[model samples]
Target: MNKLKNKVMLRGALSMLLLAGLGFHSFAQKKNWQNLDLQKDSVFGIDTEKAYEELLKGKKSAPVLVGVLDGGVDINHEDLKRVIWVNKKEKAGNGKDDDKNGYIDDVNGWNFLGSAKGSVSHEALELTRILRRDKAKFENVTAAIVKPADSAAFNQYLKAKIDFEKQTDEAKNAVANIGGLKTVLDSMVKKMGKEKPELADFQNFKAESSIEDRLKRIMVSQLQNSTFEAFYSSQIVKGLEHYQDQLDYNLNPDFDPRPELVGDNYADSQQRNYGSNDVKGPDASHGTHVSGIIAADRTNTIGIQGVADNVMIMGVRAVPDGDERDKDVANSIRYAVANGAKVLNMSFGKGYSWDKKAVDEAVKYAVSKDVLLVQAAGNDNKNLDVEKSFPDRRYEDGGVASSYIVVGASGPNDDKTLKADFSNYGKTTVDVFAPGVQIYSTVPDNKYEAYNGTSMASPVVAGLAALIRSYYPKLTAVQVKEIILKSVVKVNHNVDIEMEEGIAPKSVPFADLCITGGIVNAYEALKLAATYK
Candidate 1:
C-alpha cells in the first residue's frame, strides 16, 4: 500500500455543524453531559459521576500521574495549575540540568518540539515533508527511469504528489465557496435582533438590495437545515479556519520551520537530547483541553470537573500545529515513562510514519515499564482495517502492545445515533468507544469549549484509566486495560451510521465497529476493578 497521509484535522465539518445546530440552544447551558449516567440522564456518557457517588465515596486514593503528550498545555490555567506535576528534584529558574535527564528546568515536563532558542508553532505535514524530499528526484522521472529496486519508493512519491494536490485544491475550493459566510451570518443576526432567528424571519422580510437578497437567500437556506447559532459556529466560524490551516501549514509544501525553530538533526532518529523546557509553546488550546479532560481541579468550583480525581497531569509538548515527527513522539513516550507517568493520554495521530522503528522502540519501552497508553483512533470515517493511523498499538515486530488502548469517538445519544459520524472504526483497530462529540473541556486562558474529535474521546478513556490506577493502585496497566474493555456497556441495537454526505446510512452492528462492541461505562469499570484485588 502507498504511504497514507493524514487528512489533517477532524473530518465532517458539515455534520458537526448540524449536530451543533440541533444542540446549540442548550450547548452553553450543558455541563458535564459526558459524565451523566444513561439511566439517569438518557445521555450515553461514561457514568463518571455515578462512579464517584457510589463506588468512590469514602475511598482514599493515591495521586496518579497522567502524561499529556500533545501540542502544548496551559499549565498555569486556574483549573490545571493545581494539578500540574512539578518535578521535585528540579529547582525552578536554575537554568541548569538539575534532574540531569537531558532537559533543563523541566519543572512540569519536557518540550521535544522546542530548542533553547524557541519553539515551533507550524510545520509541514508528513505528506508535504515526504513530497519535499522526493519531488526533486521524481518530479519528471518516468517509470522506465526508475530502477526495479526503487519502484516502491517511486510509487509512494506518485501517490503523495496526487494527494497533496487534491487536498490543496479542495481547501482552495472550500475557501472560495464560503469565504465571507461569517460576515453574512453576523449581518443577518444583527438584522433579526434575536438570539435565534427562525427560517420564517425572511419569509415576509424585504432585502435592501439585490446583493442583500442573494445573501439573505443563502442564510435562509442554511437556516432551513440548522439553527442560526449552530450554522454560525460550525459552518462559518469553524469551516473558514479549517481551510485556512490547510492553505497556511498542513498542505503547504514549501513551508518549513524546523530548520529555523527546532534546529534538530531531524534526519537522525536518536537526537532526543536537544529540546527546551518550555512545555507550553505558542499554542496550547488543544493540549490544555485534553489535559483538562483527564484531570482538572475538582474542588475549585471552576469550569468543569475532570473524569478522574487525585490526578497529576504532566505536560509533554511534542505535537505541533501540523503533523508530529516520529522522533518527537518516541522521545515524548520515553520521557513520560522515565518521569513517573503511570498513564499517558495520546490524543493525536497521523496517517504516515517517517520512522516506524524509532517509534516502535519507545512504545516497547512504555509497555515494559507498565505504563498504560490511551490513543485516539482517528477522525476519518474510513475503516482502519483497510486504512492506516500512526502510533497505533501494533508493533513492527510480532506482538501488539498490551497496555495500549485505541479509542474511537462516541456521542451522548442512547438511540441509533450514538456513533460519532467522523469516528474511524475497526473491529480490530479500535479497542473501545468513549464520549468525544461536543466534549466540553478546558482550553487556554482559563476558558472552556466543546471540541469534536477522537482527540477528545481518547482522554475520556485515559481519565478513566487514571482513576482506576489511582483507586486500585495494585492493578497493572494491562489489568486496567482489561477492566476497561470487559466492563463496557454493550449496545445491542444496530446503528444506522452515516458514512458520507450523499450516500445512504450504513447500518452496521454496533459490535462490528470496535473490538468492544459498547460504550465505556465508568461506573461498571470501577465496580469490576474492586474485585481484582
Candidate 2:
C-alpha cells in the first residue's frame, strides 16, 4: 500500500510538471463553455486523441456487468438496451421466482422502496426513524444526565441527541437567514414593480438609486448572483428544511418505513420475497444517467456512448431520491454478488447510517466473492475523515474491506477549483477523482441531460473497473484497486475552491483532498491493470 501510494504521488507530481510545461495552469484558467462538447473534446475529460489510439489497438474487453445500486434504470433506453443486465435465472414475466433466490421475479433487480414507483427522502426516513426511537432518552436532560445502561442503545441514543441538537441549530439559523433575505428581496421586487425582476430591472434601479439605496442594492445584488434559481427555491432552503426535519421529528433510530412499502422489515436481509419486477422505480433518471455513463452504446449516433464498449448495467433500485437505507444497501450488495456482478457502482450516500455493521458485513461478502465496488465519496465538499458519510467499506473500527474504492468529483480543468464545488472529499476517505462536472449521460424517459455530482464520477471508475476485470480476470479485487490508485496522474498546486463550511472561499493544495490526488484515466488504468499480473 505504501509503495503504491508513493508511486501515485510521484507520478502525479511529474504529470503536474508536464502539464505546466504545456501551459496547464497552476490554477486552470476558465474556458469558454458555449457550444463546447466536454465529452468529445475537453482537457478535463477523456483525452480523445489518446482514446482513439487505444481504440485502434482493439484492446477493449468483452461485455462486463456492473451492478448499479441506485434508482431504477431505463432498461429500454435506446443507448442502454444492449448493455442492460438480464437475470437469466428468473424468466422476465412469469409472476414467479424462477431461480428461487428468495426475491420474487427479480428479472432485472429488486426495489427496496415498497412501491415500485415513488421517491423516498434519505433525510425523511433516517431522521424520522432516529428522532422517534431516541428522542425520549434526551428529553429535558442536562449535560450530566447519565444515559440508561444498554450499551448499544445508549450509545445510539447519545449520538441521536447530539445530531438532533446540531441539526436543530442549523435549521434555526437557515430559516432566520433566509427569512431575512426574503424580506429584503420582497421589498426590492415590490419597488421594481415585478415579482421576478430581471437583470435589467436591477440595472435601472442602480442608475437612479441614492448612496444609501445603492448600498442596499449592492447587498441584494450579491445575494441574487448565482447560476442557480433565486433564493426562495434554492438548494440552501431545501437543505435547511431537511435539517429541520432531522432535528424535529425524523431522528428516531427505530423508525422503519419499509413496512409501509412492503410490509416487511428491511433489516431482515434474508426476507427477500417482497418487491417486484418493476425495475424503473419512482425516479429512473439517476439510474438511467449512470447506466448511460457506464455502458451506453457508441457509434450508433443516438445518445452519448458510455465509457466502455461492452458492458451490462444491472439495475438495483435500492437508493431513492434521498439517502439510502443501510439494510437495502447491504442486501443490494449481496444480491449483486450472488447474481454474478463483478463490479458495483454506488452513487448515493447519507450522513446517518444506523446499521453500519450490516453494510460492513455485506462489503465483506462482496470482497470474499472477489467483487469490486466503486462508491461516490459524496457531494457535501467536506473533508470526510472529520465527518461521517455512508456506504463505506471501512468499519468504524478503522479497517477497510479490500474491494471498495470511494471516488470524488474533478472538473474539466487542471486547477484546484477544478474539483467540483459540490464534491465531498478527504485524504483518508476518497480514493480518487474523476470528471464529474456537467457530465452528459442518459436519463429516464429516453432523454439525455447533463448532471453533475460525485455520482457521475463513481460510474466512470466502475466502467474502468469492469474493463480491467474483463481483460485481466486473474487479478484480485485488491490488486485491481491498487492498479487504479497507482495509475492516477496527480496535481499539487494551490487552487481556488469552495469548502464545506460555505463561508468565504479559500485555496488549498489539490493533493490534500483524496488518497489518490489524481483523476482516473481509463487508458492509463487499463495499461496499469494489464501490467499488474
Candidate 3:
C-alpha cells in the first residue's frame, strides 16, 4: 500500500512537470514571433521582417481610416501632415457646407467646442456643470422643495449637489491647511534661490540637525508643500466659481446648450447639420497624442511610429478637456462612419453622463456602420465592474449593444501583478490590458511625452486594431475584436499589481484581472489577421 501511494504521488508530479514545460515552450515561441525586438533598427514599433510578411499576405494595399476623438489634432505637425483625413466633399477655406453635413466646410473634421482656444479639464467641466445645475435650482427653490420630475434629472441633480458640497468642503479644508505649510516652503524656495531645486538640494535641507529639521524635511521632500499651496487656493476659488456656474448655466438636462451655440436642438444627433470643419480646435495636445499613437507617420526617422503604416487619421475634435457633451460624441461617430473611418479611438470618459440614451444610440449606430469603438476604461483606480463609467458597451439594460472594445492599462513586464495603479479593471467591463504606463507617444507642436493612464493603453490596442483591419478588412469589427482577444498570450507568473485604495497588496494571476488576460501584440494580431485572410 505504501509503494502504491508513493507511485501515485510520483506520477502526479511528473504530469505537472510535463504541462509546465509545454506551457513555457508555447509562451517562448509566441513572444519570439510577436515581440521580435525592433528597438535597434525600426523607428516604428513594427518588426520590419514581420511587416514584410504581412505585406506579402495582401495587407499592404488596404486604405483604412482611424478617427481620433480627443482635445484636437495639430494639422500642421510634420509627422501627421500627409496622413490627415481630408473631407473630400468640401473645398478648404470655402466657408460653405459642400457636403451639407451642417458643418461649414469641414475640410478635416468638426470642432464641437466653439472657437477652441483654451484648456478645459473634464473634471473642471463636470464640477462646473454639476454645480451650475444645482446652484440654479437651489436658488429658485429650497432643497426641501427641489424635486425634479424626471428621474434621471433628479438623480443627477442630487449627485451634483453632493459633489459640489464635498468639493467645496474639501477646497476649504485644503486652503486652511496650505497656509501653515506654505510658510516653510517659501523659506526653502528663497534659500535655494531657485523656483525648482534638485534632489540634492532637498537632501541638503534634510541634513540639518536643528529644532526645525522636521519642518524643513517635509518642505523639501514633497513638492506639494509649495505646489499644493498655490493650487489649493485656486481650487477653493474654482470650487466657489463652479458652484456659481452650476446656478448660472442651468445645467438642467431640460435646458440644452446647443441652441445657445448653434441655435439648434442638440438632443437630436440625427441633426448632423451642426459643427464647423475647423479640425485644429482650441487645444491640440490630447488629440494629437492619440493620433500619433494610431498613425503618426512611421519610418520617417522623426516622432514615434503610430500602430499601423497604411493608415489615415481622421481628426474629430468632439472631446474637449471638459466633459464631452453627448451631442458632440454622437455626431463625431456619425461623421467618422459617414466619412470612412474604420476605427474610432475615444481616450476620454466621465462619471456623469446626462444624455446616456443619445450616446448609446450613437454607439449602436457605429456598430451598424461596421466601425469599431476603442475606449479607455478610465483612470480612477477603481474596479469598473462595481463602479459605473460612461462610454461602455453594456448599458444598465442586459443587451449587448455595439462593437465597443474597452481597454485597461498594462505594463511591459510579463508579471501579472504590475498592472498600473490607476487602471480601472473588470472581467466584463474591461476587454484587455496593454502598455499604458509611461507610454512615449506624439504630442502637438512637434513634440512627444510619456504620459501614463488607461487613456494611453486604449490607443495601443486601437493601433493594433487598425493594423488588423488594414491587413484583414474582410474581418468584421466583431471578428477583429474576437481575434485580438483570443490571440493574447496569457502569462502564468505571479506579478505584484498595485491594488485599489485601502486594500492589502498581494499577487494574482494576470488572467484574473481583465477579460482578454493578455497584452496588445501587433505582430501576433497581424499574424492572426493574416490567417483570417
Residues 1-533, candidate 1, lDDT per residue (tens digit)?
01111232324433233323222212332468788888998788989999999999999999999999998889999899999999998999989888888888999999988787799887777878889888888888899889888798788788878878987887786676556445555676678787777889865457776545765665666666567676666656667876787789888878988887788888999887878889999988889989988898888887899999999999999888788888999999999999999999888777777787899999999999999999998877769998877987788787888899999888888777788877889998899999887778898899987777788888999999999999999999999999999999998888767755457889889899999999998999999999996
lDDT of each: 0.82, 0.67, 0.63
Per-residue lDDT tens digits for candidate 2, residues 346-420, read: 988877676888888888889999999998887766789898777667776678888889998877766656787
TM-score of candidate 1 to 2 decimals = 0.90
Candidate number with the higher TM-score (1 or 3)? 1
Better of 2 and 3 by TM-score: 2
Query: Each prediction's TM-score against the native?
Result: 0.90, 0.78, 0.76
* Poorest 10 consecutive residues by lDDT, candidate 1: 1-10
Q: If the candidates were sorted by their lDDT against the true structure, best first, what order would they fall in?
A: 1, 2, 3
Candidate 1 — which residues are off by over 4 angstroms? 1-29, 142-145, 180-234
Candidate 2, which segments miss by more than 4 Å at Cα? 1-42, 46-49, 115-127, 138-156, 165-257, 266-270, 396-398, 497-504
lDDT of 3 by residue, 1-533 (tens): 00001111112121222222211001111211222333543222234345555543543558788988877789888888988888788888876778876677778777665532333322234545655556565545544565556445656667767765665554444334334334544566577786766545666764333423654444344443334343323332443343344333323334334444445465465666655556776667677777777787865988666767788888887775346777777778887888888899988887776566777888887899888899988776667888877766876455775578888876544444357656778877788877665566677778875555677777777888887887677999988988778766565566555553345666767676788776666666667776774
